[model samples]
Target: MLQTESEINMFNASLKGKLENLSLSSFRDLTILNLSNNALHGTIPSHIGSLTKLGILDLSMNQFFGALPLLLGNLKKLTTIYIYEIGIAGTIPQVIGYLKNLLDLVLSNNFLTSSISLTIGNLTKLTSLYIHKNNISSSIPQEMELGNLKNLIDLHVSSNLLTGSIPPTIGNLTKLTSLYIHRNSISGSIPQEMGHLTNLIDLAMSYNLLSGSIPSTLGNLTKLTTLHMGENKVSSFILQELVSSNLQTSLIPPTIGNLTKLTSLYIHRNNISGSIPHEMGHLKNLT
Candidate 1:
């Protein structure tokens, strides 16, 4: 009966053992395979690629290790892939770009290394991408054309060795609600284009090599609630009034008062100094 089955779900089943003996290759018509939250351990089976009709694959919370099999690129119909926290190591394969139908791709909390693949631009349909909490290194290349993923809503690449300024093209992702690039080695001033993220609610860029004043444009994110910019080389203040003043006093910009919905604010370990702005009181929800 496995030959005719289209989906196999063993999520959180407490199943233990490698998939080598599961005979999954017999399921020719399978379209979905979920083996998450199990004790499955071993390199992902190479023959799993034979399931050409598969659309969604989840192996998260397993004990799988080693590089992703290149044959995964053959699963052209795949739309979602979740392999979070499975001890996978090695660079993300460029073959991932072959999955053009992908919408959500989560590969967080692994030992993956090397620069992000530039071929990711090919996944134009992607909406949410999580590759955080890994050892991925190198500057995010503008050539990566992150802007090409116009449908993106959540982008997380934090806690890595990433350097270089955030590509200005990120402003093109106007639909973004959460953007996290904190805990990396990124340098340069925050791009002014960030102001275009009017829909943003959570923005974190702390613990990096970022310098320069906070962009007044950030004040435009009226929906923002949590904003963290601590532990950086930011040398100036946000309020234009303070910026224009010849005095070195760095006051919290009154424009921050505009984000009335804000509840969490982290600005510690910067060069900011001066009297706290009374406008901060407008953030009645701040904690």
Candidate 2:
């Protein structure tokens, strides 16, 4: 029961409307509810799940639509569930696997279509899972029960419509460090067990329909600093924009110049070719 910051910035009106139900439900020992950047519309009131000592629920940037409320997963002392983008359409309510002390689940840009619910491997104390730009199409099921969410660390779903591949139990999230799935429609080839994610640092998959030949074991992700694999069907290219997407194949793994903390290297349109590897000039923190 603590409301300050100007009474939660007067329910932070970004302006839309709705959420009327709880006129603050007599603050039943309210734990912490932040009405994030609001344009709040309606729905969400499954009697606010009787706010059973709620831990932290942020109805993020709102224009809030429907679904999402399985009485807010029966509020089993939820541990931070952030509903981002507001326009939340439907699905995702596998009663949120009963919230088991959830760690930080951000539903990212919503309009949720459905399918991601494998009861999300029962959130083994999840560590940060963002649903990425939504419209969720499905796929990413679990090549090993989603590596049992071993204290996952930031797994952004990336732009939606997700198709498949990438779930080699996500190399069991060896304490993952930022792995954005990239614009969707995901295809195959990329699971060289993700080089066992040596504490990755931002590995965006890039536009979809992925093909093959690039994983020189991701140069073992030497704490990479942002590597967006670029458009797709990767193999061999020299697109000055488009020469019939000229295809052929291979090269570029000069052990990715041992990723000297790269500062963003978006591989360019795909197909890839030879010799630019002077150990990528030892990266000197490549911009």
Candidate 3:
């Protein structure tokens, strides 16, 4: 067989020049192993579980420290695992719940702390789960199970320290589209089943400690375009029923000029008063 495919491409170019000779026995038939951004330090070579046909494993921005590598769950055809800004600390490796064909699992800005492991709901073919700036705390592991992730799409667990609330089954992620649970310490309310996420478009729950009101069924997410519920303690008639449901474009409140396709409004500090809506000086895409 052409000299066994030229001895497996000269043994993967002599195991990429022995990676400065830390030699973990010549990476058995390696398959797509990028030593990401290299300054490669130690650990990570439980002989990489003998490479069982690895399918893309980036040791992200290295300085690679410890943990991670329960033989990488023996790489069951792993699909994209970038160990973000590596300096990999502990936890995160209940054998990566055996990789179940993972799809983009970037362990963001690592130094990984704890929580987050109900075996990651067995990965059911996950789709983009960046573990945002770790140091992870509790709440958000109610046995984890993301109803088979129906092809999940972009779910960043924002700056950790994660507390509770906001998981009304995450509206079962109906193919979620960008949902970042902001700076954690999360309290309750705001989960009227996330208005059933009608294919959301960027919904960030600001600096947690969330209180009640603000779910006028999220105006049924008319495909929201970035709706960040600022600082929390929600109310004001649920922000006037989310500006009478115009969904977004403007509506920071001058009674949201009845949302004539709002164009970016923030409603600073709160105790919002009256009188600014001269029909918002006629939209004209507000200043």
Best by lDDT: 1
- TM-scores, all candidates, are 0.92, 0.34, 0.33
What's the CA error at residue 97 for candidate 1, in Å?
0.8
Candidate 3 root-mean-square deviation in Å = 15.1
Would you list the C-alpha lDDT of every candidate in the order shown? 0.83, 0.74, 0.68
lDDT of 2 by residue, 1-287 (tens): 23652233335755465876446656666777888886778777877788788788888887778788787777888888888888878879888876889999999888898778887788889899999888889898676557888898898988889897777778878889988887898888778788888897888776887776555566677886877666667563322111123233565545566778886555544456676767778879876
Ten residues in a row with the worst lDDT in model 2? 237-246
Off by over 4 Å in 3: 1-20, 23-29, 32-54, 58-78, 82-102, 109-126, 134-151, 160-174, 184-215, 219-233, 238-287
1-287 in candidate 1: lDDT tens per residue? 12238988888888888877689888878898998999999898888889899999999999988988888898999999999999999999998988999999999999999988888989999999999999999787574468888889999999999998888998988999999998999999878988999999888887888877667787789998877776676665555212221222356767867888888765543456777888888889977
Best candidate, TM-score: 1
Task: Give the clash count for each candidate.
Answer: 0, 8, 6
lDDT, ranked from best to worst: 1, 2, 3
Q: Give the higher-lDDT candidate: 1 or 2.
A: 1
Error of 3 at 158 (Å): 0.8
List model 3 lDDT by residue over 102-123, tens digit each.
8899998887887877778888
